[model samples]
Target: MADEATFTQLKDKVVEVRHYIHQHPELSDQEFETTKYITNYLTKLGYRIITPEKLNTGVIAEIGQGKPVVGLRSDIDALPIKEATGLPYASVNDGVMHACGHDFHITSLLGAAEVLAQEKDSLKGTIRLVFQPAEETHVGAQEVDAAGGADGIDAIIGFHNKPDLGVGEIGLLPGGLMAAVDQFKVTFKGIGTHAAMPQFGKDPIIALSGTVNAIQTIVSRNENPQKTAVVSITHIEGGSTWNVLPEEAWFEGTVRTFDGEARKTAKKRFYEIVNGQAASYGVDVEIEWIEGPDVVDNDPQLTKWVVDETSKHLTVVKPEPSNAGEDFAYFSQKIPSVFAFVGSHGNSDWHHSDLRLDDEGLIPGVKWYYYNAKRLLAELGKE
Candidate 1:
């Protein structure tokens, strides 16, 4: 266990950094100001900073020197949601806020960096601190991977704040932590017709109605009874007037699955149901699939490492698999990675305008990263 006085000192720094980031929120890849703040802070802490050209707003800082480098990651970008928390550190930028708690993630890493820097001389292996950008758009992890962020990295660790969990508790899911996310849009084309004479032209609105209803059957009938998949048609637009039949109707929705086989099967069934229904109505359909993050699968061994280290500082609980998606899945693809969740103690859901995190829960998160890196370095023969 760390000294009480030292822990208090580090916790104070964490709060300072968190509040600073909370007040000034940047969105997605356009995190110029946020990147500058992180770079300067790490440099001041005496770490070797690497700012890759590919990710203009991403920063990777290292402390100590040796093989089997352990990585700690945090996202720096904010979402496009408006803040209604009424906290003094509420987002200063209108229409932008840290609703997902990336503000705390980055600040926690910053605090860990400070502690790691103090013990740099005694450390055996290196710690790579990754300050990522555009996590809301699911582009940061991909960009970091492309920029060689995972090079020579033996194992990676990351965490997100969960509002449903109680403060001082850590949640870990061993196998499939999060689901794969994919989106799609379908456009139905038909002939326009006047309101008085319906038989003269084909009605796309009628075809869309059948398509939506049939799409639901794909989940109920095509998928296995045990397997889970979600297909939601969130948007539908078509006729301009109440009586006139429009020439086209557009529908968009998302798909979530746990495994590769399930993802492939769901996509196949979706297209078949949508296109088949359109053809039956004598209407042509165009379908477009938007790619998203893969499911986040934690390495069993790495999960154990996180659980052990987290237990030292707080109460740890194993959680069920989540349907949500995370870009961190990209890193898990390259190396053994563990993605855990810190308690947020909020009643509202994530990505909501009123989403708020318990500031007190952040200290334990900082300790987890700080101590987890120490344990990982020891295991890798760096300590």
Candidate 2:
């Protein structure tokens, strides 16, 4: 084990920061308070801070100087879920909560920032700490990247809090860490008539039902047996009353896939199925597709470095790829990156109304960040 005293001190700081953030959760692009807090903290640590023109709520702090700069990232946005953890430091904002453990991630990165700053004289190269916003909707990383966040970054590292794993364990996946997500909205229009005169009117509700059923076949029958694809119809709205035959029906849902080809194939098939089914039902249909984040692909060399270096501080495990998506995929696309998971030690699922995380897990996470930064700096020194 590492020195208990130093680790405990860092844990204490993590608790303070985490609670502070939990008590003041902000949503997506509106993270003014969160950004201010991070900016103030990092500035106090003697690091130069850069505020990009486009991203008002993002903060990038740099320490040390030289080639092959490494980057550390943390998302500062909170979900819209209401706080139900009942902790004293629970969110004061109604209908908003830190359900995703972003509070802990920011705290861990801040902890690393403090340690790295303190040891800058003994370190080599640079470390860029990014405090990002709007990760819940998977747009923050792209915004940051567009603003030249990783202009000359050699490697970017990030971590999510995993409630399924026990505390003190870090999970790293080499290849696909998370799937790509896409959302779609479809509407069918038809003639409306009395419910009793079904033969006289074309009901869009009927077409919607067929559309939903056929969309499922994209995953079950159309997709390859070895590949994973998810096509879910999460919402459907048609008739307002039982006595009326609705003129129009709307449905929306999301699709998730690991590979780009699978994602494209699923999207193409979805549009075809919806249009074909609507045409057969003699209804006019409109489909809108919105592309989302891509898969979180970890660079093999950087992932290996993370695994090897993290092993020196705590127990580490390789986890399977997750279906959920993250905005960190944007950073991974630009530079070498590895997004790992730090154990949260709770049973509650993420984005749930009652999600909670073990506060003690912050200790190991802080240590992991500290060691990872040190190892990166050391590696840069050798080059």
Candidate 3:
């Protein structure tokens, strides 16, 4: 943890940074101004700034040199949602808002930066503070890694603000905390014909309907019921007019699963259903699979180290497995990493413009960041 002086400094500056960031929010892969602001802040603190051209936008600052450097990541990009919070600090940028509490995330890391920079002289190892962009689209972590953000880093730690839990509480899961996500789209192509001539042409709509129904069996009839999996069709598009059939019909959705075997099986079966249905209907089927992050298999040792130290300073809860996917999964896959959630209970859910979390409520998260960093660095030396 930070010294008393450093702690006090962080405690005082947390709200100011959060409020400013909340007002001037930026979108993913386009955090130009936000990058400039954070760069200036870290530069003034005397940390060596590392923003490679490939990173596009984001800042990687290093303090205290040597082996076993720890990487800390916080996604800085905002979402494209109009603000409706009515708070004076609500998003000033129209059609862009930090609806997911990324503003709070940036503030917490900035606060941690203040504490770390103040005590760097007495620290044992390096702390690489990474402010990542494009997390909403799940490409920020990849961008950072491409920019060598994790090069030579011994381990990493990151956290998110949780709105369901009460203030001062944290949620940490040890294994399979979140699922792997796969989004897919299928287009059924057929000859368009007038509605009156029912037998004139193959109807892609009939084929699409059959395909969607059969795909659902991937989770039910095809896969083992004992395992967890999900297949949902969220969007479908077809003919524009009532009496005329369109030449193409398209549908898209996502699949979520905790079991790797189940995930593969689901995709394999989905393709089978689409192909079989298209063949029977004499239609052409085109499919695309957009692979996202895999299951968040939290490193057991790293998670234990975090919980052991964090439980001392704050209330830590064992969270149930979630289906929500995170790009941080990419980092955890490469190095020993732990993704945690800090309580910032609000009246509305995340991704909603009406979301609200008091600045005072997120202080424990700030303090936890310092504690986790110190403990991880200290533990690395013992190994």
Candidate 4:
């Protein structure tokens, strides 16, 4: 409900809040200090805070009353990377960093809340502010949704900071904008042997080595090339000494897919390849599959509403699908939801320690959160 000039006036305050939060970054599911800071700020803005005991971290704040409640969510967790930005507001908590730009996410939400709270009396319906935790681990949204966060909410809107496009440029995608993320860990067990030994014992390194090559075929040979999917092995641990093979070998990785069938096919082929390799090498194998967030499938109606509402304030553009998984998809799975990307024109990619973005980027982000909620209230209240 706040006009452009009103939001612009609060720009300095938003940047200040962002700096403080960035300096004291906290990891997922353990954001006690971050929660306290957000609670204090929201309370100071005259908004009522609801502390759900079910939610370990984060708080839900309410403004206004009546029907057609819309929830605006912001992820409040950081990563395990160390700060290398060397900026004045770099993380004071060593080994914990806001490389994902969650600091901006939190600050922008509060900026929107500050303006919304001032115009609450004239607003048509309620606006719920969700400060979510453990987003990096992809479990926070489920907890929030289960704790009745989406109990009465009709629609939910969320946004992330993206590189390439400058401030005020918003990225929009109608359906399946992000891939479904699944995790896997496989361990191969065999008898240890000397490097020079040819027949002394069974070797797990040979089994795991062959299995890695075989897993690649799941995408190249098994799945449809037309569809989007990727399987990447990120971590591997095997062998203790350079000249000796260890009895155990383990590797973990992630799979990304846009289609449900593709995801299933990839997982099926993955297990088959591991099993075949295990049998051939005469070694025991164990596999663990961890399900992550589903595809970020935006509601057609909600997506259209976001484009219409955002076009009134800034340029709206279409962006390609992203492989990076987002927990916001969990919110979309529960209700009619729209997830957006606000460009920051940063030099480094997300999750990098050298990430850099201008503080001015938070201005448009603030207006986005403010206008999205206010416009949703207006449109939904009419129905």
lDDT winner: 4
lDDT of candidate 1 over 1-383, digit per residue (tens): 35657778777777878899989999999999999999999999999987677788978889989876999999899888999989888899999998888998988888888888889888878899989888889999989988987688898998988888888888986877888999999999999999778799888888999888888887788888687788889999998988788899999999998888888988999888887888899998999999799988899887887788779778898877788889988888788888988887975978887877887877877887888888888876733
Off by over 4 Å in 3: 1-9
Model 2 vs. true fold: TM? 0.96
- lDDT score for candidate 3 against the true structure: 0.87
> Per-residue alpha-carbon lDDT of model 2 for 10-124, expressed as tens digits?
7767888899998999999999999889999998999889768888787988998877688999999999888888888989999999999899899988887877777777667
Off by over 4 Å in 1: none
Judged by whole-model lDDT over C-alpha atoms, candidate 4 comes out at 0.90
By TM-score, is 1 or 4 better?
1
| After superposition, candidate 4 runs with Cα above 4 Å error | none
Q: What lDDT would each prediction earn against the true structure? A: 0.86, 0.87, 0.87, 0.90
Clash list (residue pairs), candidate 3: none
lDDT of 4 by residue, 339-368 (tens): 988988798889999898778788888888
Q: How close is candidate 3 to the true structure, as a TM-score?
A: 0.96
Considering only N, C-alpha and C atoms within 3 Å, which residue pairs clash in candidate 4? none
In the predicted model 1, the residue pairs found to clash are: 124-382
lDDT: worst 10-residue window of model 4: 1-10
* Structural similarity to truth (TM-score) of each candidate: 0.96, 0.96, 0.96, 0.96
